[model samples]
Target: MDEVSYPSADVLKLTYVNVNPTNINGIERSGTLYSLIGDELKIANAVPGTRVFVYTVDGTLLTSSTTDTQGCSTLPIAGMSGSVYVVKTSSVTFKIRKL
Candidate 1:
């Protein structure tokens, strides 16, 4: 048989690391690429006139729109509150939940 030994709690050392907290309230910020305001999905830094599509989680097409001159597209997500959907563009594809 083999015997095992364990370290005592009194001899243990703990290290603390600093962490930067982030905000996840769906607001547009420096690191946040997208934001959802009510039934409108806003994507930052997109190309102007880019085509955007919104689909259900099950791959059902809900709606589509094009970005304006400001590279922002206001998607009409009526009747999709509290539901998750997929948004896709020519350069990016991501999922967003309507609040």
Candidate 2:
């Protein structure tokens, strides 16, 4: 009998806002993801603390963090590549791909 092995990675939490020291929450819009390179994932937003999140197109949560006061957040993307990026919110979401 042969055993099947699947590659496993750690699951990370995704954040959409920075620590609301001023308020329990700030202006929220769910979140978005963008392709930084050819089939690559990176942070993309008009400003920091854009309440952005990075994740797998398959709806998998990767490294996540609330956008800094400037709406800047860090996403964990290693050994993963794709032309599509997924964005999600409490109600809606969309994808961003670069050609």
Tens-digit per-residue lDDT, 3-65, candidate 1: 955677665766557644553344333332567777667766677788989998999999998
Residue-level lDDT tens digits of model 2 in 7-86: 55543544567566656453355454444554444554535545555555787765455556544455555555545656
TM-score of each: 0.60, 0.37
Worst 10-residue stretch by lDDT in candidate 1? 23-32
RMSD (Cα, Å) for all candidates, in order, is 8.0, 17.3
Best by TM-score: 1
Model 2 misplaced stretches (Cα beyond 4 Å) = 1-50, 89-92, 96-99
Where does the lowest 10-residue lDDT sum fall in candidate 2?
Answer: 26-35
Q: Which stretches of candidate 1 lie over 4 Å from their true place?
A: 1-33
> How does each model score on lDDT?
0.74, 0.52
